[model samples]
Target: MIAFTAAEIADITNGRLAAEPGIIPGSVVTDSREATPGSLYVAKPGETADGHDFVAAAFDRGAVLALVEHDVADAAGHNYPAVVVQDSVLAMGALAAETVRRIRAAREADGQPLTVIGITGSAGKTTTKDLLAGILAAEGPTVAPQGSYNGEVGVPLTVFKADAHTRYLVIEMGATGVGHISYLADMVRPDIGVVLCVGTAHAGEFGGVENIALAKGELVEALPATGTAVLNLDDARVAAMAGRTRATVLGCTAQSAGDAQVRAGQVGLTPGGSPEFDLFLPGDPNGHHVSAKLIGAHHITNLLAAAGAAHAAGVPAGRIAESLSAQAAASRWRMERTERADGVTIINDAYNANPESMRAALRTLADLGRGRRTWAVLGAMLELGEDSIREHMAVGTQVVRLNISRLVVVGREARSLYVSAVNEGSWGNECVFAETVEDAYDLLQAELQPGDLVLFKSSNGIGLRHLGDRIALPPQAPGRTATEGSALL
Candidate 1:
């Protein structure tokens, strides 16, 4: 973070000064294990653990200041050097807002400009952020979220990494309900907002799919009149967002939608399942062709969203295309492709799953496994509210329609998928129900043959990604015998 004394932080956050820390913090950390010299540790509460419990460990590891809900005591019973606030997470947001103000003011004084881009959607937030970051980083010093760090705490942490020299700030915003994105946007005050498709990923928390659209539109609604809003025209809900923001609308479309500012023509996937398309930016008669390193045809929208955001940020269209083609999936487990020496191609897209992404993944699997056997080890999509069972059944039906060779549904929550697949004509050995990841592992270990393609997909909490990691290993590795591997079939 920008240099800040404990007093300054206390004032910025409307917090009270505890024991005077007489120190200037150079960075911010939430996890105590990540604390370093001059770091300000945030004692925020979590679902299972409280951050207040780690304050002392942070101090011992070289933290100079702590932002806490209550003053923490030392061995002498006196309070540790800290800034006490009503809520540490809210204080972090306050600090982040102030940090952005300072950075922008400094840049203005130097005749340079700081560009902040906010990206949000039910899916594709991280992938788009990664793509935008890749293009922006080549232009200047850029700061984007780590992994899926797009929540209240995650956004502030991302802002803390920005300094005076930082030229571009790319934030991924995620919301569970109404006003969540607005709350995040109030902190960073983005110059450009990118709204990818609003899907059913968080339909449960937001009450319904319509509410999700309302929530995701908050990012564009937060943009200034002078700013730009990048909306995916392929999604009707997102296309409707153009009217919701005062900012200029820049539409990104894959299907040659009418008058879209960013268009992808002749879209097709490479043999390896990466999207290849002709990218047409505003005023470009001749579009630049991009053969993306990302693993699915569905990523064409993400590519266009990034291209639109970069163009709004003042990068040339040619440069954006070149950067995008070279940028593979940077974050883990989002169609992350791993080819073992045994000729097994494991597409680990287990980071997170929704109906739209699940279908995209299944289609990509069908394309990639054209002449080879395909296995789909799917877990629950999660948080669909009333639509959960229907959605899982839909995915199972798609798996059968796409002609996926084997179906292994790994959890009780996702048992509907197995039943639906069998009901949809995947009878007998084609579809199997495994009560646990271990059972699925055993089933696959015995059945998977050379040239068999596998896809692991589920919500993050399902832990299917770890199973994918275990199964991706070569059969001859360490403890497993050929006889044991041969029996798994």
Candidate 2:
């Protein structure tokens, strides 16, 4: 990432070097499949598979070295070039921290500036990261995560993508417990920290909503006094973070009447459910208008958050608006709208979910399916802890209130939603519960019409996104039609 030799990498990671003295890894990766020449592979244990097993595979892909918890032997019975550490994940973080330090030092020596922006929240972190990246890229070179790569290992992998020529690094920080965001902040040390809304996404893991706020605030807490903190004024929990950091605070809100330094006014949705609004910045009295290609009104807050960070990075208001308007949804499975050739519309937001985001998607679905029949194929929202039942019940009630045509709850974990819908007066065929994704797919296939709008939402674990993908497919050929007992589409 910063042209560090094997000796320097071992020293920086506080690990013993077992490789050739002058070897240098140009990049760092965790997956063996992504290894290339001059690549340093970090072999760590994962939930699904142990990365240590792929060390030889990585080396075979032209990797110069591997960072591992145990030494890896080559075909010659000799230890391959490696940096042996107690924990390969932590060693990778150390290497990333040093890479950032080196890039900054080099930029400082060349009188160039590199602005690192850290974004965190219970929901919308990836969307905001994508939006900010688009706005920042218009100003200069920017590096951002590919998708929702905002976890412990993901942050360092994103950091390793930065170099001296990189002008902006947008780091999305996600936390399941206390100190998680703090741990990420300690690595990149962002110059501008943006805190979006703190919601009940991870309330179960953090024990409560208050703990979520505490964890998300760590991003702002890591900023320097000279840096700026862009906070969401609409979310009281995030707004309270103004006192947590020494950095100058810049508040952003979706309301024009608010006292926020940056605000959005005249908000409205396009026919396709995308949001369009007048953007108000800090200095420019007459603000610019931005119509984002991103769907749902919930994106207004995300757009404002991106504008606030872009403003802090010295991007002009007009350029920010232009960049935002030109951008489309870059990440997959989050309000991903697909129009089938048969005239059916599919909204696949099954990437991940929480109470706040769930409500937002349901509302957007209701709005977009105004005159057309609507189908909500939902699954369980995981990690909601003790509030799981109440939250799920509330979503069911909201769906009914929205006047949706049909509700299909998939899986036993999501039984609460089906039962709540029935209890909420949606009886008989109005609400149906399926035991699996295949059952849900069959039910929708038999009932869906050409003009109907279907929405698929759940935590990624539910696998409903694949169901949405299957539903998005055009009508099958006469002989290739799906059968009840056939394999999953």
Candidate 3:
């Protein structure tokens, strides 16, 4: 939002200026409730609600400029310059791109440049993104996408955060269908592309895994010749995309994949479920081992992806190792553990889950369970389309294969998992199906005993994190610890 006039905003978005507003400032906003002074509230027509209805409300709440799909009332004492466009959402995107250009110009004017890190993958992108931001912050100022804001609109908004002091910009790119990544790629044009292991995240949306590969590959496909593509060597599909880019390829592998540019060895889980490993980069003198504080073996691969990406961006091996150990989980969501007063430990992966990620989460629970009852409270994996049943069944089977003691499956679709598990050998007695979290919690109260290790996982739509919170902190009572509920056998 480098202070632009109504005329400038109209020109950038290719809209018609309704009136002349002198040097009126522009701060991009989509939500009218979040509108502030001198803000250019973009009234977008969405499936549920249209912002055009709130144009006057935005102006009343300090907004001086409006981007609308159609003419709105400038009546009722509301007098702000308006930009009428055929499509306000598209205009927001175009304006956001223009905003990024202005921000870059301001940074260049001050003789300082911003380095952007573009990350896209099926799983581990968020963790890797959080880790990358922390590592980048270790060196200098950095701004990462807050939460899962990594789409077309989010990408440019993230890029627009760049200023004179902003040094490194970490952008996470997420694709729902084909060509989504390409649009974001066309925006930031990151110097370092971290293509983490591509799995069946949105396989059904883009037809299949092959199309998913091509979609994620869009980020690195047009990278500058000198730019570097950081890929996961352990994932063959992502590894195969290396040569598809003009950028130099840097491969990250958790396993000793015989041939890899950057490999992680001597891997073992720390006492707190963190990973301790040695990172071997290309042409390095010996290797530097990292005792990472993040949870799960899957994180070993994520850490390598981040390190290799940073190395490709010119960070030396020694510095990358330091940055790896220096990294910590930003919150208590991803595999976060909390020991209840009843001695129950809850592992929360409720932020989001897919077939690949859910299996990794269950495996981590098996690896870290302290000879206690390992319980998995899983929810529906959304956006899988036609393959949802098969995928959920795979999750149920994986639970049995891992020898987890108890399974609490939530969500309507998860009933398929329960049915699949019931059909399997040695899994029928271990599985329990619930229609909702409330049902699951009721069953949990009756079935779970003290010392049971519980894991809560689901796509964000189900809000499965509530299960973790209820377990971690039941209503605090005097003489009762943070985890007050007593576990029953």
**Which pairs in model 3 have colliding backbones?**
none
Instruction: Give candidate 3's error at residue 278 in angstroms.
Output: 1.0
Clash pairs, candidate 2, are none
Model 2 C-alpha lDDT per residue in residues 184-207, reported as the tens digit of each score: 999998999999999998789999
lDDT of each: 0.92, 0.90, 0.80
Question: By summed lDDT, which 10 consecutive residues of candidate 1 come out lowest?
Answer: 480-489
- Candidate 3 stretches with Cα past 4 Å from truth are 20-23, 74-79, 109-111, 426-429, 475-489
lDDT of 3: 0.80
TM-score of 2: 0.97
Off by over 4 Å in 1: 481-489
Instruction: Give the per-residue lDDT of model 1 (tens digit) for 1-489.
Output: 688888888999999999777678889999999999888999999999999999899999999999999989988898989999999999999999999999999999999999999999988999999999999999999999999999999999999999999999999999999999999999999999999998999788899999999999999999999999999999999999988999999998999759798999888988788899999998787989999999988999899999999999999989999999999889999998988888998999999999999999999999999899999999999999999999999999999999999999999999999989999899989999999877888788888889999999999999888788877777666786645654443
Total clashes in model 3, counting residue pairs 3 or more apart in sequence or in different chains: 0
- What is the lDDT, from 0 to 100, of the residue 482 in candidate 1? 44
**How much is the lDDT of residue 204 in candidate 2?**
90
